[model samples]
Target: MSCWKYWPEIEEIAETLEGLGAENIDHIDELNKIDIEEVKKQLDRIEVIAHDKDIDFDSAKHILDNERMNKALKLIRKFYLYIGARLETENAQEIIDSDLDPDEILNKFHFYERYEGLLENESKLAKFNENKTFVFIGSGPLPLTLIMFRKKFGCKCIGIEIQPEVAELSRKIIDKLGLSDGIEIIVGDETTIEDLDYDILMVAAFAEPKERVFANVWERVTPKTPVLVRTYSGMRAILYAPLTDKQLRGFHKEIMLLPIGNTNNTSVLLRKIE
Candidate 1:
């Protein structure tokens, strides 16, 4: 269910998409064909409605639960991800080709400030075992999450990246920071998980086809192992796909949802119940 209010605003955005010739908003291919800027404008308006003070939490949740609205939100999120990935790819290529310090590049990442706030939250920090190891899936060029986890928890970390160049660059950054002893950067995806041992699994925010990954993790990891799935909530839901109930089948029902700072990003904590 959605946690967003302002049905009128959402309806307007849906109408706009439909007007643009979107036969099925839930289809990613159709959404990708639409002009990104137009989609972004609609998303911006939806965000404003999400933050409106007059919209109560219960009402927003009810609107979000509507099937049609949910499909529209999913399409918007796909467009957002498409645009973001294109931009990120361009930026990563430029950074990799430049002589800029890795530290400086890491500092300039958009999510750096938000992550700092999240790392400082004691209640959320308590959820992880400080003495255990962690493996972060989809660890990108910077591996900031692994860096933060190591610094804050004093725990060992292993980052899995699909891109060889990104994995190499992340390793260089880790070595530059003298954190090589505490963290290891591996170049691969979920397949690499089998060769390593970790106490916790952290799913990166931009991880694609999360349902499949969650199922793979469930089958691979030991029972009761904690899995932290990072997802978007509230207004951010339009920019990132959140996990659906169908994808959570093998997990315990007693789940915990922790918001990261004041952002629409949240960490869904679950244990392998099967």
Candidate 2:
């Protein structure tokens, strides 16, 4: 959907994916029709350019700064999130149903492998035992991260979601899962991070305007507080926009762990610069 009219070279491609979206296309629909393979081919190319081992971060910025590719990535990102949202909402509802086995429904999720890696590696990435009140921004409608954190780590979590309806839905899911005591979903946004006294702060991959959010966090949080920002790179950036190191100027990046799975998020552990 980028530069269909302005750029003749990209016009044919943009016009092809003109209707790429969730309302028109279900997540379960075969992506082959959307030329996903072609899109992936381009992403693989970008992955090579951005992560050639010797290339500096500028390689990635080159892709992000490119107006044509960036626009297409953004459009595809929205479509991807829409599909994921629908699936998660459906799964949440299924868990809420008294007749359905929540375990059965959860077992169908493709993220078990990913979350298990997180469960095993979180301690190595960040300190969670010192204090357990963790606040997660952009927790979404299902709050799966909070659920997993509470269940696995015995930690308490507060989810701050910008959308009121989505936060309410997440609240329902937590209650239905009988985890109300360990997790709470509130209707708020990035700004909410400042008002809460949390042992740790986590920014989800979907949180918008990464630089602004991190700046706000830097200005508001106490000195030396732990911050974990979930980021994506390489082909993963086709879905979630990758964060540039420049965006995190006020934080000391302590440790980074890239998990291998569908969740393939790079967990960047940060501490506020004193």
Candidate 3:
């Protein structure tokens, strides 16, 4: 939460961990929640600010009890602390080897990325067909690509997001833009590979790297499913299903890169045949 109250503890912990010569770190994801060291670092700073301002537990508790001033201080700080504690730990190095929840981090990241702020009206939606079911591998800035596809092809879209926040945002954006009926956003990984019969699968390459881990996650289809993948720069060499092929493609003749606050030279669109 607020670095004002938790900074000292976090720093102490980080320093202690540092002294212990713990270098490697791992992520924690439970119930679509991410436990990250960065958030813990921020909490440590917040604790520092709290001490500098002479604010203590009682003061924070008081402010939190009030409704009016809660937004500026209490609410933000409290949630920050809650999230920080959930995602991070003092002795992460010792547990780094344990199973980490990648999906939790992905879902949270997805939720934030999708609905952090208002998207301009100029942003386009990906193309899809309602009559067909499609799997959206990644929900990045180019989610519009999927939206457009849904509108044109009548496809039912199952969008998988890495971050819970981004997934929430995507849901909000879909609801706000009146696209909810067509797209079903799921905040997690696709596990049932063999059972999925998606007519097509779409993904944003740059958004979800290290995709090799989930390479065969897609389920088996009858003959082949059309997978249209988009990449910002020149496409990296990635093998697809047997009958798939790559081609330079774009929607609305433009694609947005939200993180960089710009657009791309061209979106590398791939069409997977089998």
| C-alpha lDDT values of all predictions | 0.68, 0.68, 0.42
Stretches of model 1 off by over 4 angstroms after superposition: 1-47, 50-57, 61-72, 83-105, 120-130, 176-178, 253-255, 258-261
- Model 3, 47-147: lDDT tens digits are 44433334443444443344443333432333343453343222122122334442233234322332222122112323434657877666542255456
**TM-score, structure 1 vs. true:** 0.71
**How does each model score on TM-score?**
0.71, 0.75, 0.38
For residue 267, what is the lDDT in candidate 2? 84
Q: For model 2, how does the per-residue alpha-carbon lDDT over 95-213 read when each residue is reduced to its tens digit? A: 77756766667657645566667656565665665257888889987787888778767877999999898888888878777889889888877888767878888888878788888
Clashing pairs in 2: none
- Candidate 2 lands at a TM-score of 0.75
Candidate 2: C-alpha RMSD to true structure equals: 6.3
- The number of clashing residue pairs in each candidate reads 2, 0, 54
